[model samples]
Target chain A: MNVAKHMLFPDVGEGIREGTLVKWLVKEGDPVKEDQPIAEVETDKAVVEIPSRDHGTVLKLYGKPGDVILVGKPLMTVGEPGEPMPDAEEAITESNEKKVEVPKKEASAAPERILAPPSVRAAARKAGIDLSKVSGSGPGGRITAEDLEKAKGGALAAPASTHQEKTLSFDYGKGKRVPLTHLRKTISERMSWSWRHVAHVTYIEEVDFGALKELRGRNKPKAEQMGFKLTPLAYMVKAVATTLKQYPRFNASLDEEKAELILHDEINVAVGVDTEEGLIAPVLKNADQKSVFDIAKEIGGLSEKARARKLSLDELRASTFTVTNIGSVGGVLATAVLNPPESAILGVNRMKDRPVVRDGKIVIRPMTYLGLTFDHRVGDGADAARFMKDLVEKLENPAWMEKG
Target chain B: MSRKKVFEAQIEYLQILDEKGNVDASLDPKLDELTLKKMYETMVRSRAMDKKAISLQRQGRCYTYVPTEGQEAAQVGSVMASKKEDWMVPAFRENAAYLAKGVSMRTLFLYWMGHEEGSRFEKDQNCFPVSIPVGSQVGHAVGLAWAAKIQGKRQAAITFFGDGASSEGDFHESANFAGVFQIPCVFICQNNQYAISTPRARQTRSETIAQKAIAYGFEGIQVDGNDVLAMYVATKKALEKGYAGKGPTLIEAITYRIAAHTTSDDPKRYRDEAEVEAWRKKDPIARFQTYLKKNGFWNEAYEKEVQEKAAREVEEAVKKAEGFQANPEDMFKYLYQDLTPDLRQQMQEMKQSLEG
Candidate 1:
């Protein structure tokens, strides 16, 4: 039988919803084996080679290089040798029920789609409010959770009503509208999934980083000689890794279907890096098995790769634990969302001079807040609290980092 | 009114095999060489399967598993003591008991993988699926035993749980009911010290878990859970007593959870490495293997062959489990023989969502 099989673009990495066709490894009429690399597609993480799942001849190619393809959209077609080719328009009409077309004018009117996170969208939906009617106040005019709350409280009642009444008369060319990038779309889906699925309980603790600062100061020259800037994040990763060795639940993932917690033996710490495109976390594999210097070096290299968009799928995935340094990005404190499947994520905040009573004497010390968001379904609150206490103690005395 | 001494319970402790692989002749379970060798090999095979499960979980091929590293003797010996026709109820960590009862390893793997088919077994197998809720299996075992009693069947039911389950109210209720009815049921409590991260000390204030059975008007005995011979002797005696219509018996096996509570747990959180090392020296499989070699029933070559055979069996089981197709809609099928209106709607909705 000369049946044709349409191959869609598979998810190349975790949470990747779309990819750009970088190059077609097989041309039309080329015979290909099952599992052969048929095309190279550029996902948000890296360039991945999409393989053929059927052994046959490539009957038709759907997209050209540099064209964007949605996941589950046909990338190519494989059929028996010399089969009658289906007309492109006929193929399009047959799959038209699945295709969605957004008119240009309608796309510009919904500018809020480019900014708000999933939680905000969900809250807006539940409140029966149109997201386009609510004005965003966050960075890049992104809608915050508070914005949704205010909208629910009728704060935007006037504008919303005005928008409804002016629906027919409103001008479409009043403001510029930008399309959501693949990275932004991916982040939206992933963050929404994480927020919805994980039972997040965030615990925040403050640590005196005086000794750590002094240690970093002493090691700065040696680190400079080694060709990498020494940062507190490196020390934080080390402390988290060490603490996880003691409290393994934090270094675990929850499989809800199986009702099991998957505790990982190796500590792979992911550091969230902000780049020009968006936020990307690159993993530092086997952090527990590495020394502070080695961790710092890998952190430097991985961060560079992240910013340059050169991180491989391997580097961008497989994180048993995550540490986001909001401190470097100038935040005093923030509760992070649990990375999906991972039981916990640690957020490091900015360090500032603070006065505190130690040994009945008031002294100014460098202190920073460590916010740990954990999946309560996998562990108890007491477990998270104890883990935080141990982490604080380890960060307070980073002399352990110098031992190895 | 003058106060009078009402009740006193004397708990007997059994230890046939010591840490040094020395078996007390008086307490020895005098089985033939073939059965002795089989018991030792089963323990080794269980250990091999446990290691394989751990590695497979790490590789993302399986879901989280509770390794039965230090409790093999408690599992294998008790299951071996039960007759083939007797009912066996198991908690989540009773891999040794499952393998010993001739349940295919693939069924176990499929169960852990979250497939409903994994719970399906032949009618005559008489082995229940793994129970996740702590101590709930006790009631089921008691009910099964009571049903057998009512039917005039000679089969006894053996239920396996942990020390953690001893704290649950179900255990108390089941024990009370079993005692009142004088049913043929054996409650095997493998006290592996910690329930997840909580220590056994926190699980209960009582010094001995077996003593709890005395309050229900039944005999309670403690045994060295690391000693296979002791476990066999104690369980055998309890099963015999049950079959003789003497009521139920709670056998508390003193053992340590050498591995984490599960793949998702870290024993180091609430336990000391030195304590784990101390327990390592008293490993049930190691002790049993040493006893086997000392009795001329095993040698290095035979041990190697046993491990190889176990590995091959586990590998084949993994392949079979991986090959099995999982149907999501099958979850609703076994819930009711005739699906209710609500359940039928749910099944339809699930099918729509999956198809979408």
Candidate 2:
């Protein structure tokens, strides 16, 4: 069979100079995909599972387990099955070939040559004591019944913590105390840190959702056809992203060490999704760069992923701001704690038809109370007011969102 | 008949000091003892820093680093020729050049450790951040020189590149622009035999990179890149011509990359160990140290002091770099003067993900 030989080198991680081959996942003549795990390499950073850089059958194994491989040095040769192995000049010759021939696999299935007699073995087996682990004091290191008795109390004893007893206090009423899961722990730590560090200021404003409701009605069918349910939160995300361009300070994080405000350039909005377990926010990346319809579709997909607990790490990271739609749960107004380093969070309350005077006349309008919580260290009250003013305008004039 | 014998250009080779530490007194620039001592110390410090960076990369403390092991004389000598007010434009391999321009070792270590603050130089430093894209900084150097000329500033610009960069369109474009405008710029191509794995022979067919400058209507000279005095003399003369409005000068420093192109590269795959061994004998640091010892400017005690001082400084820099805490938000902060709507959302999304 005609075949082209390609060398496989160690590219385990960036800045890694060399690594020891811990084990080979694929052997000679095994088929491999482009990203299939072929070997495990231990570098200074970590033990990395190296994926194949090409698709072919492994023609030759250049380095065995425990062999040190330099970063650019070839670790294997991959080619078609039954291809002729490269000559001595190209492949790592002589020593490596001899080393490969020396089998390093352990004879794991061989029964242990125990020195105990049949009666002693029977007794030890009955007592559940392993005679192999006991060092016999008898002649030629034979295991006696006495040694077995001593070993029973030593090696195979149960762990200490499993049976430890503790005194209970019944002063308080009986209740079930459950430990926090990983997600809950993360939420507690982050919220506590944010609350302790940030100097928060909450600004509440009433936003007219009449234009957004009309836009949502017009686009709901089209959104459903695209396989997603459209909601007002999508318009809110677009408005926040669009208004962030004008009020960049609100989309900034304060670096306490450097004492500088870091303004982000990409407007990625994290929508808070209420799941059965807890609240999880999945990010819609580059919200301003996307259309309202696209944002709506992503919001639907992300919320589903969040609820299913299948959201990938990339989908949940690098968000510049957050929008919590408390409006769906029927809240008049609610203030959200600032997500640390994010500077602000927008809490959208429920929209309702309320009587208000626009031009000296009583009018029924769909209005919602929007609460903006910001870090006072990063921006002032005026900055927050100006930001909300721009956001409110964009939400009220929702036609502008359709264009871009 | 009109095309007969119109013009003839020749490239001059300059070597003030030999590999054996012998100097041609007539060609010596006669730099003061203090300046000569400082030059040697800078080269030593640059070598120490390069060594430390490579070690750090191997230990997983630093990122992929480009070592300036063999090109110290080329960088330091050229920088010594220019004034502090002159702008310094650099390619990625100019660690020694940055050191000579007063850029702290901590800043350099921080940069290699993947911090953005590493590139933030003080306003008076007049040094640009290390340009990773090969040959791209050539245009910036020319532009800076042009800007200075227009603003009636008395300063010039010195740009450092490699032999690999000479083949880039940016290099040729910058040279043509500088020559046409007679801008105050000095281009130093540290022709250290190999650019990563590609050797000088494969990089170009030209007999010498310096000769390419004649086509653009300017002077070009080749210097023994290992000879510090020769490099300094060539750069000083080029800077003088630039200040006199005589356009730009290209100096080709013939040296060898004694170490691998970078910490990630293995030169044994493409180069002969014998060649590397031979070049190691003509080591720039050794040659300069020899010259200093012969002139009585360097003694055993002084050498010990300089080495210890360099080690201490590099250690301090490493500690500072490791201790630095970079805010994750800094990634988006420097992209623009203010965050765009899209970027603002992106930053928020990142914060949420991390906090969550």
Candidate 3:
């Protein structure tokens, strides 16, 4: 008796063209039930588990993890035990052929860091030779396919090994060696990565805090009634978001792999919170669309959640720009490191009563320094100056805050 | 000269059944036992299917779905008021209306599952495919009614739209055309308080959506959409007027979208949770069930049977829909009576690629 096989196709979400096969829950020949989750597929929006449409033994697993499956493409085949396989092999082979062709083309188009021809590089890849180690005999140290053949089965034939540098030890020997927490390790890795990749140019601007102070004082009682302290950081975030609308370059991310700059539509300002464990930035999503009072309350809640180590992943991601307040810590002025992907970060430092010449006479005014560290890859120092000037003007004349 | 009132218009509000499930006996349509039971069962099925569809979308079995959780009475009641010959033109969120008009649950599920085959209804079903562009279907509905009128058919056309559609120029144009031609049409606006994030208040400055019909020279009335009896009475009256060769009538059914605008939306972003909680009390299904029980048309056993039957039907439909094998060739077929030269070449190429 001939039994038909049931193919499980993807129906992840609307307008989702394709998804990455994250994992398969069931292997071939395993019996599965209807509506049983068969595989985890990551779509453009989120990771979703695609369930089996019929109860039967899994006949064929279509693709492995990291495989790109198009929408409406069958992920697997299920059929009765001892059933003969149908003509699905052709479709599977077709998809596999397409996937195989993509990577070969991408590898050939890689940046020309090493001096080698495409054919020679392909031969080196097949022979498992680290071409970078082979001293080329050609002009300008170009490795030929002949050199690759000669290097095969030799010391340079092995897969590229990671650089293992030795660390110099000091004789102090009396300090405790506590392992870094996951958060600390993550922060360290991200900061170092940002520092290495970003072309950072920080610009500092001095602004009078008279208008901002007066505005905060006027709203302080109202904010207190709403059960949260109205900090200057809220005003700074609001001002930054407002100014970012004009300076679109600052409210963007650099896609280094794609060599593109993505201008974010929403101004999600991730405010840096110094918790007991380390520092974490919880995003106040769509800060430009929100009122200062709402931002203040959200900041308070986010700080509480951050201190309690209870911030959700959604709250910690998709921040277009970052704001770090060094006021409470009493910093005169500080340049902050750029958050990875984000084009810029604003560091607001402590306020001070400084003597300034006003109308040719010396006078005391409350002032603060605003530092803007931006990715020069996205903009220049002149653009950063303009952004800072706009921000400083907004901070000094903050009558717009009352428009809320 | 002394000032005189040249013209005056008043919008009528009708409510046969209160929120507490008490029906005014004088205003009740007095539907037969089987018809009443069918109406209630259809609403319950719509609700069950809506819940299941949302779950399916979350589980990645279905795509984004526009749920009809709170506006079932408005949909079922209005559809039940029309005859089988009447045309049902619907916007996207009319799953209840479609179900009542003899469109299968499997078809709707398949459509939301991202299949074009789902939109191709049975030949006898006079319901149009789901329209995505807001208020764009109003013109098609008016055209359908105009065609019927030109052909000397007595069947009236009924269109379903949301409060957001009321602001669309298509709706205004269609209403004006319908009124000028005295076309046999019934326009039902499911004023579910929101069009995505834009609330009804922001959609228009009109004091009431029903009053807008006065400008188009038609009688418009508002009804408590959650009250099945009120919706049934109002729609019945409007359809009667439509079939009697009188001009079109607009029925503004006041309701709320208890769920998100669609599966992808987050109502919490714009709407208050307390508002949803309050609307939950006025749920159409629950309210109708109470009315049915008080009228001796429903009991626990019947309710259990209806619910179990709906659940079973929905599961079977879902199973059938998921098992459907859509042919790639169908994409090229049915779009035109004869494929153009360019389309034929593309089809051949697609077929060759697939076979390869």
For model 2, the local distance difference test gives 0.83
lDDT leaderboard ranking: 3, 2, 1
Estimated TM-score for each candidate: 0.54, 0.50, 0.60
Candidate 1 residue runs with Cα over 4 Å from true position: A1-404, B348-356
Report the poorest 10 consecutive residues by lDDT, candidate 2 chain B.
Answer: B53-62
Model 3, docking class: incorrect
Tens-digit lDDT track of model 1 for B80-139: 888998999998998889887878888988887778888887778899988999999999
| Candidate 1 chain A, run of 10 with poorest lDDT | A159-168
lDDT of 3: 0.85
Q: Pick the candidate with the highest TM-score.
A: 3
Q: What is the lDDT of residue A64 in candidate 3?
A: 76
Candidate 1, A1-404: lDDT as tens digits? 56587765654443355677767999998998755778877765355566676788998888776567776567888889777666555555555653445545556776535578988888778878888887888855888987777776575466555544232566678685655556677788989999878889888889999998888989988989989888878888988898899888888888888888899978998899998778899899999888888888899999898876667566777899999988785867789987676889998889999999999999999989888899888888899889989988888877877742
Q: Pick the candidate with the highest lDDT.
A: 3
Cα-based lDDT for every prediction:
0.83, 0.83, 0.85
Off by over 4 Å in 2: A1-18, A21-404, B1-3
List the candidates ranked by TM-score, beginning with the highest.
Answer: 3, 1, 2
What lDDT score is found at residue B292 in candidate 3?
Answer: 85
lDDT of 3 by residue, A1-404 (tens): 76645454545465556776767999998999866878876555345667776678998888776567766556777788778766766545644553313234445877546889999888888877778887687756788766675566355434532232235887978796555545666799999999988998889889999888988999899889879999989999999999999988999998889999899999999999998768999999999999999999999999998886656567888999999987876868789998888999998889999998889999999988888999999999999988888888888889989853
What shift in Å separates residue A263 of candidate 2 from its native position after superposition?
65
Error of 3 at A128 (Å): 43
Displacement of the residue B81 alpha carbon in candidate 2, Å: 0.9
